[model samples]
Target: MGVKAWLSKPLAAYVHKKHQSWIQNPVEAQQSVFESIIKTAQHTAFGRDHHFSEIKTHADFVEAVPVRDYEGLVAYFNRVKEGEQNILWPGKPLYLAKTSGTTSGTKYIPITKDSIPNHINGAKDALLSYIHETGNSSFLDGKMIFLSGSPVLEQVGGIHTGRLSGIANHHVPGYLRTNQLPSYETNCIEDWETKLDQIIEETIDENMTLISGIPPWVQMYFDKLMQQTGKQIKDIFPNFSLFVYGGVNFEPYRKKLFESIGREVDSVETFPASEGFFAYQNEQHDRGLLLLLNSGIFFEFIPTDEYFNEKPTRLTIGEVEVGVNYALVVSSNAGLWGYSIGDTVKFTSVKPYKLIVSGRIKHYISAFGEHVIGEEVEKAMQRTMQKYPMVELVEFTVAPYVSQDKGQSFHEWLVEFSIAPANEEAFAKELNAQLQKLNTYYDDLITGRILADLKIRALPQGTFRHYMKSQGKLGGQNKVPRLSNDRKLAEGLIESADALNTNKN
Candidate 1:
């Protein structure tokens, strides 16, 4: 057996045992996780303050530790930051996963010695499970490249701080480290342009077989590789067989990635966050991730429809129904207590427990009471793309333009297209119609004359890339906001496009 594959046997065994525990009875598995964490952390301040010692059941646990967003946990985290042990988790964390959310700005998420194993071993099992099912372990023999953030982490208080990918990379097994690409020095380059160049130069001639990154940055690398080598990805590395991705909806970029690679390859989708690694696509035919019930992260769901009410129902694994949108609440060994991660999801299956990410709870555009969401917008774009053969989407964001001068308001879409539609007017009309059909409030606003027809501004090619680069968020994991409550992002994108055109002129 290949050395990497040989090293994966133990992980495969772990996944086998864990997957059985999950699917046999998901509710029971999640209960086991909850009890374990509560028992371990009962001595901590958060546990004692919330009376976790007296909590004997899931319902009691929920009542003890109220569901909280990052803001609610900040006070407890501050104590941990000040070199306090057993404040949130069992001990002080060794590293912090620094996250600058699109709206929430910078947040330093904790990563503890107890919690780090969940991230590492679970990640290892995800790959091993994919291999066990696909029987495509030969790819492990060739170079595997993960396009990640800078490995050079900054010290925050007493802990090392960096992006989650960089923190995870630090714990990469010594065996797999040999097959990994891009020297540590290359990965530490702060400037994405410099790092991309160095990675391309270093791995251009390697016998690469596996690739992993978010879709957008991977697309960027593919574009550059094709441009420099004058060859498709398949031609460059005939053995290139796997592409693993996460952190954004992959459907929009699927066609582009296929075009770049020039052939179909096996792919695995994972749901990972600074909080914890939650789920992954366990079956090839089943795209919905098998929820990691046995993982160290305990899961709860508050139906989004009822979330804003005064004390909405929090459903355990036993209560969740397929097809309902729920705001995911998590309590992980990583020291978070009943934390709302802000992302929303819909369960696709309830028996074995699987789900697809719906959208972020805070990322919808409800200007003028239309209440449009990211999923609706994405579906609209997908529907339009089906009708227009000449059009390809790069990235898009929508914002309301309220002009006091005219006393009217409309959504202004800043969209960068790879191939311009043959008829922009018709394209916009159909897209608007599709969205109208999806959300009744949006249609009512248009019909009631409360909002004008959507305005589309076709951005120049590379506008989104340029905008992202300008913000120093050119890497994967950081996505351009799809829908904004305000015009800040829309105006910034428009300004960036204008600058690009001005330079060209």
Candidate 2:
């Protein structure tokens, strides 16, 4: 075994021992954890005198702290940006993790030292879970590759902030850190073209044993690698053993990734956010088990129905059952209290807390496992649409449709434009190509001709406004849902697009 592997085993053992205890008695663990979290929040300067008062009991604490969306946190951080200390946690925040927000564009999320441990311990649990599930201890030895977000820490008003992926890279254990690839912190490039090129240069001829990242970004890298080397990923990284990914669903991208690599490798799905690493794929690749950061944060789950209507019912870890979707709520040392990160998950097995990511409770769609959420589709569309100056998109929505013939499902993109392209068909084709290129699962589904259909409808300039008005949500906080997974909602969007087109002509 390599030196890294030799060192990792004992570390893994220690982690597993602690983890087993928590998993075995999740209820007692959570109750004990909640009490400590309340203490931290009550005593910490950041937590004291905030919106929430001291949570008396675990039950009252969960009840008092209502579930919050991204906007609420953004508002809190904006206060922090204006030199307001103790917004979320005690002391000055170490840094902020910038992420694309659903309604508020780009968001700056605070990360404190207290919050950092949650991420670290969560990652450790993820690694240990992988080892236990796959029965492969060799992964502990392999050089791991993480296809992460741009690591460029932007200096916002003298405070450095960037994506959590980048921040986490800077915080990994020093001894375990490898020099095989360009450090994310140093090789920071936001431009996809420049970033992909840099990544190619760094990864070339590297003996990477594990790969991790968001699904689309990783697929993009794999496609570029194949084109440049003329050799499949398996040929390049023969030692590759595990494909670890989080942030987005890998099911849609799985077949394509496996095809390029020539075979299926051990895959682990992690549910990590700027706030915390929530869940990790266990020994079984089928479902991700919730490895609650008992030492760092307290967690609650609100029923999916409650979240959709903006009513939050806080559920303890012990109370969560299988087959029911729940919106995750968390309170951490980082200063966030009863924060809802907007992810919807369903428990597959309660004993070990194995859960499957159902979909985003807001702003995403996942039909046939394509998992094209709002932010991802928007980013890809923006990047591709910008390529052609003539193709100006005022607004758009991607909704899933089921064909009447065989009840087969497909994605219909409804785009409203200020000006129509001379080559509208070509624009549509290119849009599909860009989506496929960015995410291989979409590419495979489109190419293999498995999905029902991929259609694009271009409407008049004010079509979006008309549609929004019809829905009685013309302005303010309401925006077009990027990925409309609901069949009825998809059909409604299609009708609106048709109505706009009819009015234009």
Candidate 3:
């Protein structure tokens, strides 16, 4: 082990012990965080508007601040954009995590001085937690690559504004900075393809130990590496032991990733967003991520079933039950109050409050009253893929396909396969069967003759990548939705696939 790796072991142990104190008393930790955020921002514009001064309890908070998404919070965000200090948080925000918006063109989420630690520490703790558990600090000796956005920042309301990953790039710890890969100029390349190529060139021969990225992008890097050198990732980076990923489920990509690496390696999953770093996998063997209770954010859970109701039941950490899907609402030091980031999570353990991200609130399909979610589709796909080992998935999406000819509509699965299955019909049938088994409503729709069997649109490889590139969302935290109620994205993907086929013919 190198000097830093040797030094990290003791530090990791200390951090682990400190983490246990908070883990053991999650409710208390949250209560403390809630109080701290509320008290600190009590005089800010949002705090004053929401009567944060008088709020003393979670109930008071629920009454004072209504749950709102980005669109709902745009008014205050507009003030912040226009260089207004104390509009959301006290003084001025340290940075704005600029992300793509749905209805709105662009979203500028504030990253306050108080909230910045949560983002940085959350990532720090994940790696430290891994070190503490496995006693494998040697990986820290090799070069680490975080496949991320450019570190380039632009002025927005006099605040440094960039993608969350880019903003995070500025704060990579000094110790790790020397070990971090893909030189600053390479990272600053705007086009994802160019950046990716540059990254491969920079790190291809380095002693890359830790690789961090979303599953799809990382798979692209792996694929590129194999094509460039005709060598598996394990051969290229013999010491590559840790695969740190987030933004999407790793299960679907697990088979392909391991195949590319030529062996299985330890992986860590994180629950991070532009708003806050909510959770991280604390244990190597554990199933769920440990929700960060003392991360300068207060979390609320609105049961996903009742989330659409006018007055959804919002439960605090003390009240949430295991296995129930709940939309995650957060009030944080960043001056966001009762903000719903649209993520849905299901608690697996209440003892230490570990949860799995279920899906997104808006990223589901209920077009035919079959309320299918991302988790359901992902689970089905995973199971089916397990049975068909040869079928390596590049990417896939599910959307409702309404028949215009008065025929029954169906759920469409647009899949790009790196290695297609031998029997395409059987693969589609098994995939549909798996989905039906997971979602009773979808099963009912098929059995009741209300909908046709889920159709598989076997897209040509690189179709999803091309589609994403066309929309200018090629990389860095941008992921294709797992489920869509409407066919807007599905139609575009279909068109792209058709174009590719036409060009080939």
Candidate 4:
């Protein structure tokens, strides 16, 4: 191992120890950490630019830098197109990670050579921590399969940015790179169908010891494998030891995967974005998701309720408390200072800084004045599933829409199932009832009968794949959107839901 790798273990140890202490004494620890980050941000590439140069201290950093949405990013990209070197940060970045922006279209997030180490190191710590937590070091010995996005990079007016999976593939050591299932260089540019076919062919005979990627793609791969072999996943990859996933919640699909595979697999959650890898599942899985506090990034949190309120307050890692939802913000070496990624997280425990993702700040349904968040939907679904234990939900999504004649808004549920209840209508009613009970706002809407619709569309086995295929977004970094709040996107999703219902009948 190189010097950095050699030093990483000790660094990881130190960070873990310090984080434990910080969690214990949150206020003081938070101040110290925030001050250090502010200092770092002011001196690094992020600080030297015109946009960030004006800020000098932690308070100034928070106040001067306005909270930005996708539109702000689009404006930055316009500068990038104009050959402006530093819109968000100083320095000519090495590459850009292309991601589908929620609203303002596609985004090309700048990634510098200095920033890549943060991602690699954070991922390394995540894997090491998982090993320590589960006491399952055997996973490291096996061939790990990562279902990533296309590796192809497109040069837009001489600026390079490709899908995140492709970038990760290209950055891996050459020796380990050969072990990867689909060659990133070839697969990144290949059509989705061709790529899926290649993935199926590669994994058919290989001993895939560990599988990692977005949940939806993993599901699709497993489904395809089962169809091809007529054998359960357990029969095919008996040695499969781990399932590492991120990008979306895995709870809904967890039971179904276990049922199909016939065994429990060790699972780890990763929080990575185009900007950088932020957090990972730590040694104490119960403590919550571990933030990569030492990843050359300054972290901040805005209380969930304060996000929409004017002049929202920011909290440092040390100041965050358990059960409080906060919008995650980061100032990274890659030049994004005080950037909010739109993810909302709740600290499960304060002592260890363990957190669970609550939901995306933008991804919620409030059509009928009932503000339903991702967590609310997840809890409702979990309760419904508990009530009806026999049926397995393969995939599900929730959207808010209004009935034209009724002039009242309600939630519509679309569920894809492998095994549905004997009485579908009764199942739907029970699910709706569970949801109403869990969320009072939903209950009020239902009681008033203002909630005009509660629809469940059971999809065929491969229905979800159609959306992934149509978008040309599968594997690796791309994830199936769970909760869509945007009206236009919801409409497109409804079309797919309708198609699935049509196919079933």
Pick the lDDT winner. 3
Candidate 2 has an lDDT of 0.70
Report the error of model 3 at residue 362, Å: 1.9
- Candidate 1: lDDT of 149? 77
TM-score (C-alpha) between model 4 and the true structure: 0.67
Descending-TM-score candidate ranking? 2, 3, 1, 4
Deviation from truth (RMSD, Å), model 1: 14.2
Against the true structure, what is every candidate's RMSD? 14.2, 7.8, 14.0, 14.5
Of candidates 2 and 1, the better by TM-score: 2
RMSD of 2: 7.8
Question: How does residue 124 of candidate 3 score in lDDT?
Answer: 98
**TM-score between candidate 1 and the true structure:** 0.74
| lDDT ranking, high to low | 3, 1, 2, 4
Q: For residues 1-505, write the lDDT of model 2, one tens digit per residue.
A: 7766666667677777877887898788887877766776565543555424555776666455556776766667787666566556655678888765545656677787777887877876787756655556675575667666556677764567887877887777776676334565435665555666777887777778878776656766787798899999999889888887776555656777788898778877777788777777766636656767466667788898877565566788878888999987778777777788777888888877778778777766655545455766777678767877876778888886643333334678877777767787777777777676555446545653445446777765777787778899988999777767665655666677778778778
In candidate 3, what residue range of length 10 has the lowest lDDT sum?
Answer: 400-409
Pairs of residues at least 3 apart in sequence or in different chains that clash in candidate 1: none
**TM-score, one value per model:** 0.74, 0.75, 0.75, 0.67
The residue pairs in collision within model 3 are none
User: How many clashes does each candidate structure show, in the order listed?
Assistant: 0, 2, 0, 4
lDDT of each: 0.82, 0.70, 0.87, 0.67
